[model samples]
Target: TVKPPVETVEVSPPETPLIPPEKERAPSEKVTPPLEVEERKEVEKQKEEEIEVEVSREEKEEEGKGELKRRPEEALERKAPERRFSIKTIFSPLTTITESIRKRKRRTTALEEVGPPLVKPKRVPRTLKEELPPADWRVLKEYEVRGGVAMIRIYLDPETSNYIYWVIEPPLSDVEKDNLKRLKDLLQVSLPYSLEAVEEERREKFLLEHLDKVMEDYRIKMSENSLEKVRYYIVRDFLGFNKIDPIMHDPHVEDISCDGPGIPIYLYHRDYGSIKTNVAFPTDEELDGFVVSLAQKCRKTISVANPILDATLPNGSRLNATYGREVTTRGSSFTIRKFREEPLTVVDLVENNTMSADMAAHFWLAVQYGESMIFAGGTASGKTSTMNAISIFIPPSSKIISIEDTREVNLPHENWIAGITRGGAEAERPGDIGMYDLLRAALRQRPEYVIVGEVRGKETMTMFQAMATGHTTYSTMHADSVKSIVYRLENPPIGIPRVLIQALNLVAIHKQLKVKEKRVRRITELVEIIDIEPTTLEIVTNQVFRWNPRTDTFVYGGHSNLYEKIMDMEDLSRDEVLEERDRRAEIISWMVKNGVRKFWDVARVVGEYYEDPHRTLSIIEKNPEVEGNPLEVFERAAEKGRKEHLKAKSVAA
Candidate 1:
């Protein structure tokens, strides 16, 4: 607050005028009368004496030594003394200068008495609330993703008794929307041209640094927390799948589908199955642009001329899209099949009850002994997952090659080659590198094991040829039974000869069925191909394992040719082979119990077992309930083996 400026009153004689003369004269030109000058001198002397006394008294009062208790009447009487002289007599230059100096001093003293001015606190900018699910819906689960920038809510709709997948993100305020548009515009021009070439791990950091530069240059102002909220959106849209980014981040989500514009996107939850989400593009242009962006992200192109795009995303998710309304009536559509970064292991399968420990052990033995197998199942029946899980059983030292139209198989083996097919530029297929080409080339590499993502075309024949040539192969197919697998194999597109089918020694049929009112995937049957009947030419088979729907358990057929083969190849007694199988089964059970299910962790343990079985078994027997990092012992063993291998190579050189 400012104190009022001090105002001083000058008392003049009653006969003298209070205002200056209209015709003012300069000091040099004016001459004062003798009587007036003498009177001014006397008046100035009296005023100086009174001023010094009043100033001394005021200073004493300020120091709290005493109070100036002069009455109002006495103050008036003191001023009355000044009225004895005429204004012209007392208004000498010296007297006027003294009065002006006194007034300025009073004003300065008043200002010094005031305190610091008040300051109002800054107002925090408000943010929009996150949108919520319907009031009537009950939330089954709610979890944070994208570092709490987004949330996933699984709610049950009372009206339809269906679960809804709801994605909640901070709603953009009008100011934020404008700022985002500006930022995108600025970033387009300022960002480095080689952004796409950045490594996946460094891309986020790079973009964040670039964004900071751009925003700073443009003079954007925001709180640190507000800046982070904006950064989340920028990263989500620029580096991730815009509308479905939250769902994509969710580990439990396996698939995401967009039927068309104005339709809610759907996602497949591992526990809740298929559910409709709350995010969608409301306009055809928006969806078409998104689809085009997806194609570009996959390093492919889609347009009205060639509307359909089937490719693998950078993160190894399978993307199938159709552009425009030419092929699909509902504007544009897409389906993404997201695979886990760390593929499931056989131990994970056993833990999830997708297959029993016995079945996993059987696969472990078969895969170890170079037995070719095929996983047959309907769509979304966990065919590829099961195939991948069992693939971890392949001996770690084996040279493996995998070819696919879209990348899905992920392995922890070092001696592995991953190949993806490339499409031709034209419809005539002049330069198309199909899966068959990759598979054929892989065989030339002399891989000890071959993995085909799926057998839907002529590649099936090459796969069977590889199996016959003793290159233990694994693949998946869109068939639910051994007969259906045979039918597809012997049909036009695949067209494998009946004699060549015998090369496949094992087939695992997977099916999706409801058990205990919940949808689940199970290996319905594990069958083996024995031989072709001489007279009827029917493919003879042995049922090694079958799932019992009533009890949700697997029943062993009591006999396995795999065991007989093991006995002959290893030259061990039948009891000895059985005991080994049982021991392997026990090891699988221990892994499941101790939660050693990560792909690389399982691979380390398996490799250690191959390098030294007795040591592995003894470790497990001693520490049945291993505390932390269940594969610690196995990892140390693997590390030692690596050092030895490197040393031997160096010595040889």
Candidate 2:
């Protein structure tokens, strides 16, 4: 360590430097370069000489031509080059840009060299005259106009020329004819013009000849299988081979029901709803064959053993047929119910005067309040139609179970379960699952409402039991009045006791009346079940409302005992009850004003009001004008009068 210290060396600090600005340069130093100065002077001299030459030339030319003289500087300045262009030249740049873009796109889309290119086989060209055989062809039919095209139907025998069979020719122009010939040549087909084609008068003769040939050929084929007469009838009548009836094109004939072979056919027309058709079969065999044809169209079969067949036609109309005397007492009978494009609605019923607006409203309230009801009517009395219309009154949020023997109920509700019963087959022992089975199952679902399409068996007992056990139910029965309904229910298969019958809140009797020569369904009576009389095993009828056929109006006879019992249970005073009734009527009137003419529409509104009576009452009070009708003033005054009357009665109490 001591030796290293002796060899130590010293280092000096770095020296500082300074820079000078151009303003501090020496007085003798030059700042400009000689070459640059000389170049500027030469450029100025050249510009001046060029200006003087131009001025002299301009002055001489101006003096010679007697035009205005220009200044030396202005004369020397060159004018901008003038641009002149043709249309093509103006678009030349754009065209080039477009071509370049197209070329680039083409290059990008070109296939890559993945493999060798495919070569297609070359097609050979052949002349029509060489391939076709010599045969006498005839024009079957021809329709033409002077300046317009003509349509020609031609028939050719395949044995004579297999390449050319039938031809539908339209008159062609010179250019089109040439094109057609070229087409015929390319296809190696014949373009022979028959004598009848040129002769318009002879076309009909040829047509008849071809028709006879076709008919003879068809008869031969059909006769081999014993179907000649059947085929003839089909071609002559149904298919309209010669002439078709205009009525066949009508859509409203839902069904064509025929009881016997020689009987007239009854058509279920859509407008003028049902009528008897003029057509009839001469014999049972003919009718049986027709029914088989109808069944075949429905993709079903009919036989001697299974003579009775129920099937849906291609057009969705339901067809029922009975072959021979097996199913029918007389002969082969058939019925067809045409599918409705638009099903009947409550509004439709109201508009058709099927029921009064108040009756519809009452049904709405009844359905909304969960009152069990039965629509009693005879056949064609619109029992199912009335049920369908009433079903729309079910609350949208409720769970509904509907049992039907057929698919008839068309409800708009979302939370609904629809069940249809199956009929027993002839082969094996019939299943026990009938309407009663479905009705019983429906009760297990804990439904808010149960609907039976139509009661005809023991199912009525179960339905009545369900009604008695706190389930709101609706059903239709084949009867014309309350007494008939009770008699039917208390009798055979549906044997429900009179006590159980009292569970029903209302019986709406629908009757089919011939009003103005038109069949109309009318709710003749709406009877309430008051109680079961001890004297007779029959239910007491409290007629709440009745329809006057003479006046075409519905009349309220007296207070419904059911409603009075409900009022009494609620402990409401007489005045309060009257006020509530008036309120209900006002709500119904409000509904009518708002275009609520259907039972279902009324039911929905009433159901909503039932859920929150106070809110509905307040709405009515606040908006005296609902849907632009000021009924609130009258309602408010009536409400005030009722309140005052209630106070006076309370003081008396």
Candidate 3:
């Protein structure tokens, strides 16, 4: 066994070679190239020198905390890598991951601590330095910052202890903040003391500095000549702080009149309804200048060449002005009739006691039956208002045509055509379609009704012709009575014959009466055009139905020819027609009882009855036992009429 073992183990396990300790060197071992040994030694020495520098820097930092010290700019120095390894080995995955995580956390903490940075843009400042005003002038208010300019309100203390205000234009700039502080300092020094002497001395200087710019603006708006005149007035009137544009927009002023240059200016107030104001001019020259300014505003010349001027204002008001030497011997005169914001209606007339209910009702029936009516009255007798109110009775189905010099008729109808005549420039001008032309054209249009605002001239003939041709026409003339109307029509300009007057169904004379210290309109007479004899025209009148001067009440007659005509047309007996009239009155009374006194409500009820008479009757009967049982009265009157008619027939048989 020993021999076999020795034979097998012969060279059997060259004992596993043991590695030498030098060959198994640790990772801390530093490899140095033999050729660069001196360089490595120098590098080591430099690292030692850097260690000394770091120690000194630490000592300096400690000393700086307790006392003043110099900067540490020369302390930091470059150093070599501590450990030697391959590039890939030096930047290992583990080391890289740890360093990246540490850097990310530091950035997150910094962002959290700082929050969002401010993003507002810097503001520009406003300064008042170059165009330096008086030292006493200080800002009182500021308004309307626009286009890099601010409207600054400044105050000045005058001798009267009153603080006068002025609007100043200030530029926005970078030094505006500092400039404002300087202005405040100047104001504080001079504003509280009596600086009138200084102010007077500086007045001309300040005015000269700013007047050019202000005058330039005014000159751009007006001519150079006008600017000169306006400047004089501005100084004379003490209107330096007032806004002329806003003054022109005063609504309570009906007119602004100035007779001559130093004359007193007058303003007609709507509330007072007269020409009176606290404002006035010192001299006739000033008044003349103001007159010229007003004329310019009207956009019409009022010189010797154009003496008389008539124009419409921007506010829809009529203006009339006369030049001194041309139209009038006096310097300059003007009158402005204010435009109405709201027009008067039938109810307004009634409420104002301008017209009676009976007159209104009669006119209503007249207009409804297509009868020709003429309204005669003096100036301001509410002729047009009465005409307008009566025109509302025209049927909805009828075609209406209105002719006038200016649009005035405001009738509420579905089928209506309004025509206005064009005034000729001169007497010899042709193609001027006056009222005559309008009347002729209206006839060709086949209108059921024709309305002429005012009949003045040969237009009377055309209106009469229209009435003769079966058109229901309405017109107003300037007169006091039916006789006067006839006289005026038959006179020179309007030669309407007496026989033609018979074509008119009725003539209503309206008069302005002074009652209770107030002017009121009343229908004095309502005459029927009965006949025209050789030398005289006959008019049938119901004086009993006239308005009484003593009692201020309108009297009623038993029956009129108009009532007969309506009865005949409806095939109703006299009693039945009277009953129908009473029924209508009762309905009106009921409406008044229900607190419906308005004319529009009355009109609506009347229109409903016209639309469906049977339905209206049934509605009235259903509500019997209530006040104003109109249907019961109608039925009773109708039965009585039937019995009377049968009795008459029996007597004839």
The candidate maximizing lDDT is: 1
Candidate lDDT scores, in order, read: 0.77, 0.57, 0.54
Q: Which ten residues in a row have the lowest lDDT in candidate 2?
A: 105-114
Top candidate by TM-score: 1
Question: Per-candidate TM vs. native?
Answer: 0.77, 0.52, 0.51
Cα-lDDT of candidate 2: 0.57
**Poorest 10 consecutive residues of model 3 by lDDT?**
105-114
The alpha-carbon RMSD values of the candidates against the true structure, listed in the order shown, are 20.1, 34.2, 30.2
Which regions of candidate 3 deviate over 4 angstroms?
1-324, 424-428, 534-544, 578-609, 613-653
Residues 309-408, model 3: lDDT tens digits = 6555545455677766455654666665554444455555555555555555566667777789888899667787778876766777789999876555
Scored by lDDT, model 1 comes in at: 0.77
Give the deviation of candidate 3 from the true structure as CA RMSD.
30.2
| Per-residue accuracy of model 2 over 43-69 as CA lDDT, tens digit each | 354442211112122113333321123
Q: Residue 428 deviation, candidate 2, in Å?
A: 8.3
**lDDT of the structure predicted as candidate 3:** 0.54
Ranking by lDDT: 1, 2, 3
lDDT at 187 for candidate 3? Answer: 30
lDDT of 2 at 200: 50
